[model samples]
Target: MNEILNNLLSLHSESEIAEFKEARNSFDFNKLGKYFSALSNEANLKKLKCAWLVFGVKDNRTVVGSQFRTNLQDLQSLKKEIADKTTSRLTFVDIHEIEHPDGRVLLFEIPAAPQGLPIAWDGHYYGRDGESLGPLNLEEIERIRRQNRASDWSAVTLPSASITDLEPAAIEQARENFFQKNPKLVQEAKQWDIATFLNKAKLTINGQITRAAILLLGKAESSHFLNPASATITWILKDRDGLERDYQHFGCPLLLGVDEVFHKIRPLKYRYMKEGTLFPEEVEQYDPYIIREALNNAIAHQDYELGGKITLVEFEDGRLCFSNVGQFIPGSVESVIQTDAPESRYRNRFLIDAMVNLNMIDTIGSGIRKMFLIQKKRFFPLPEYDLKDNRVQVTVIGRVVDMAYARKLAEYPNLTLEDILLLDRVQKRKPLTDDQAKYLKSLGLIEGRKPNFHISAQIANHSGERMQYIHNRALDDQYYKELILAYLEKFGTAKRVDINGLVLDKLPNVLDETQKYNKVKNLLQALKQKGLIESEGKSWRMSKKI
Candidate 1:
């Protein structure tokens, strides 16, 4: 039954589509309704005979059986529940249950809403932008409604496909990378021939190459699998006037085309100052580690399921912009930047893990944090992010900020990690939270509101003689007795309260108010013992310096 059911989930004969959910506990009624409306509309638009929603797959896209919420009859009401809430009675065409060996699979076979019919949820028109369910905008709704005139890329498999259709070199590279990634499977994987390897990699079907194979490892000529537009990366170099100085299209066999994109990028030398000096300490403009991490992250995590190409743009103003065709699952850039936590949802789980195991990216979520930390340490502004046009664009600034300001930031050792990140935001003239502002003020460090703050004037050298007179002198017993004796020698007396003006600022941090008073009292007693000063109680006279 398990082998028979496994055949039910294949692309060649898929009775159902697959999706992973750790538990049905996460099912939000409202969102699920929207997904049904959108996915159904997409299925209709793409002319897929049916679309499916399955559950219980893990991050590696493996079917990890899940125990669904088992008020079994309760799920039957879902189709009617969605139709009643949606506009124009839009809903699942049908919902079926299949009992597999491990667990049950719920199949929602959704018919296309209709040609030119826009599907809506709760009276709002809906559609999919990749895996997301969003209320349909006028343009997207029209695009889907008009374009449902064609077939989807996923449903197509090249019929004449064979191992000869794929690039031998690219396939070899894939095997080397895969074997290197799964060391436990080293001997098993090594013994397998090319046909066996291709099948195992999901690039082929039943030992025969398919469209996915041609796309992943095909030679330049076979890139027809990427139809309409070619599988390419376009690099555009612009001048100060926003005119394109140069443009090039990188082609197939992407195992190597990716590196060509890298070679086209140039990161220069950056100069930053550590002190109040004229010269700059030199560092690479773009940290190689960070740029590589960002680029590979874009490539690995992008929605290849969507047709848009990953983009890397080099600007004249010393910036590298990387844009991937997908929605950032983490929501906001500030949320990710300000907190030191890892991501909750990944855009492409399988591809990201593959890249991770291959050492293209590290798994611990340290790379992004390191990028911010390194830039902050160098007093460079933190990286910026923009999500627009259904794409995630990250801009990494390569220039340095003012040297004098950077110098001051380097001095403070008591600063917390969060404070450093916040200060970088502050220096960028960005808004911060109330707790963040309060934290800085409590340190007696910052003075102004919001975007403006500086080292207090009291700490600055321009405080002149007042600070010096305060900083240089001391109120110790020996110094006081000397003062008293000098007074007695020259003028014969010293006033009690007059001694208060003698010294104070030279006191150390270790001394408290009570200890300070005791020290002063002890000084007076020692002066009396040496006959250096005569305390007529309130008034004391100095004798001489001993």
Candidate 2:
């Protein structure tokens, strides 16, 4: 344990937690909140468990520790001050005191930023670029505040350098992709030299080379700009329960690493019903759209400023989890998918620029939104975000997940993205706010009392019987069509009352007496119009089409 602590001894850097170093050892209450918001949000973006604010540390990276104040009251005071300005009345877990053999350390372990809302510092939002905190640049701030965490990261480039240092192979690939994306550039493309093209591609810094230059074009061994932090993505295959089964790591030039990590991520064959039909159809376990967005977003948006690798975990039961080292810039997944707004900025401009030029991701703010759209079209559970320990974790269930649940969700097209995000929290067995629980109950998706929610049996298909679905479909307009056809083929309908009795149990799960009565009335009217079944006074009989 001490050995682990020994390695962590040199971990006073703000990049570790997304928190900033206070130029002055003493800062007031509002400033404390600002640091918490800055560090916590950045931690989530960086994908770390916690970002920290130490009382004593030299700019040179030495752990001098502090002597200003070490009393428990002072530590507790920090939490109260932050709570006043933040939503959810946030507070730190604890202000830690670590006495190294040489110096005394005060580690304020800030939690991850709250999901669905940006951590505003005293009514104003804040953000950090590297180590500096400003008014949280509007473009980048809005993108993250709305949960566009999957926005491009690689487009950000080091401003001081140009294209000369970029690798030739990566540049050549970029040019090919550019010509392919904009075919009109084909004739003019050949006319421009590499430098002119790189300039046009925004891969160069005013005709100079940048660290981003080395990252994308420099040899694998030439990545000195990102010292300590490796620009590598590691894929780990796992079983259904998340136990590791296999692993592989990938790195720049990103053009190759992106494809390498993708190949390593195992895709499974899957099947589902067509939107309006009830039948079997197949798609890759990992939606190609989802997989591409996730993989590219991880590369484009990762905070290489933090020294860690992006992780992709593929589970046997058909779930792929993509995580990277950085706080989720778009704050929460809910806001991103719900709002129709565009994201303004990214973390890795250089990397994202290259991907955009390479046709890997959209520079406009539609990445996560598109991911949500694809999942919804497939009737899949929405993606989830885990924001504890200062890191961001996104989990996408790839298989035909919970058919009944998917069907029930399809029934309610009005369900809000916020509600889905909250349900995701519940499914993970994480604590939900009272508002969240109330919302679930209102939708009849959950039952039972506080602390224990039994998914409504109707939606859960608790009996797990195909007959339950058969009966349930009898009452749905869409399902009614199928049943009318099925029932006529099985037992020629004789009495309207009999057909209602046959499907009464299914009605019990979904509706009250009035809804069931109305459903039966509607089905009878439709069958008669279709000339399949007609009512003779109070009785009904099937048409002798044969």
Candidate 3:
């Protein structure tokens, strides 16, 4: 710590990659976030591993004490707060607190912006012009964004590994899949040796094994060939409460491990009645194609350099979460779904190509969209994506979350995939942006205000969701007031508990217990304000005016 601080202090002034702040008592959070963005972007542009933001320091290199976030808990919480606002939730590598002879110094170690992604704070990109902080220029942003263009980690050759390092079984399976994919070359491929076949299949370069080969076909014991990068996939079976019931880790060759991981997941049967049929329809909890596509996509796009294993978590509630370490290259799932086209570029070009050639995945970039379509067709909730924390996680819900959503899909076979997606969000109670709300509202398919929307009455009637809609819909306040007045007239007086017992269950189910209580309180207050009811020592009675 002392060495690092001395080095920073040795600098005559703050550089592009370092900022000094004399937060003697406190510091503005917005300024701190801006510095995080600027320092991170500057570090990436300078090709440095990290940047520094030192507290309790002056621009002239004088050390003064800082009382910023004196509490350790509050100081540590800055990581999440910063991540909440920064692009990809990028945060400090580590925060170092130093007790210097001159004062208490704090060092915030900020990692460089990731390749292809410039750090943005609250939607604005920031950079450093010497010591001055400002918006990151277009050229600098493009320069950082273009860093990913030439890098292909999977295509890199591993001279240390050879055919002997790969599993014979996995290679044979690959040959079979490849033959199926390219039947015209079967006779020609059959005559070729394994080395020639591997080269033709794009798994190797000039008879030398590549990381893609190691990941897809390397022997389990040969995983060490990748060194620091992991060629592993972990499958965890969790109960409804999220407690791990069982777990198993499978290593390369991932081609065979995919099947092993798939079998570990129990895709139980899910039964739901068809729209009009009294009989229930039974289907596999998860579609086999969805499972393979998700797993293969994870393996194909995983940031192996991150040294994190791909994880597939199966919950007893009939959902599977497939996660891989890396950013979703296409940026957002909506872009992929909306465009329904191949991505312009990929992080693992070599690996993806090899997998596509083997028929393990499609190159059309419709895999995720296909997953959504399959879920929609089955009347199951669409797949959910959580693309944050420097990782891409996709959750496939096998069972139906809301019968109303499934019924809606079943009855309205003509509904566009986009409409189904927005409806899915409504069923999940996720917040909808203004445009989304406006579009849904314009279609007359939803009701209520932002964030508390419910299926409109017309759709609810046609979809057999009237009961659910009623539960979500609040009755008119006048009706509730009338009920209260009638109760007071019949009972003469009503205690708070009595009023709650009368009205709590009557309120819309969309409001939680707390909200229900608040609603009852508001109702009584409104009546009191109108002079229709009066409070008499913790009880209520009809007012003389009424």
- Among the numbered candidates, top lDDT falls to 3
Cα lDDT tens digits for candidate 1, 1-546: 344335445534222132334343446777777767776666765667556565554434355565565566777677678878764455665666566565665555665654445667777776666555566678757865454234323224677766776788887788887777777888999899988876666556576555445655678888876564346667777776677778777766665666677778775787654444423578878878777777777765555544567677788777778887655766776676666576765654544544554446666666777887777666667777788644788888787664433544555534565677666665565666788788867866444544444443333332222343343224445665566566556765557556655533345323445655665677778867766566665777754444
Q: Write the per-residue lDDT of candidate 2 for residues 190-284, one digit (tens) a residue.
A: 88998778777766656665555566566576565556457777888888677888988766676667767777766567777565554348867
Best by TM-score: 3
- Ten-residue stretch with the least lDDT total in model 2: 16-25
lDDT of 3 by residue, 1-546 (tens): 899999999998999998999999999999999999999999988989899999999989899979999999999999999999998677898999999888999999999887777999999999988999999999999998787777888999987888999999999999999999999999999999999999999999988899999999999889888866789899998999999999999999999999998898885898885556722479898999999999999998887755678999998988899999888888899889999999998988999899988879988879889999999888889999999777999999998887777777777888898998998988888889999999999998889876678888888898777888898898998888899999999989999999999888888866768878988999999999988899999899999886
TM-score, cand. 3: 0.78
- RMSD to true structure for each model, in Å: 20.1, 15.6, 5.2
What are the lDDT scores of the predictions, listed in order? 0.61, 0.65, 0.89
Count clashing residue pairs per candidate. 2, 44, 0
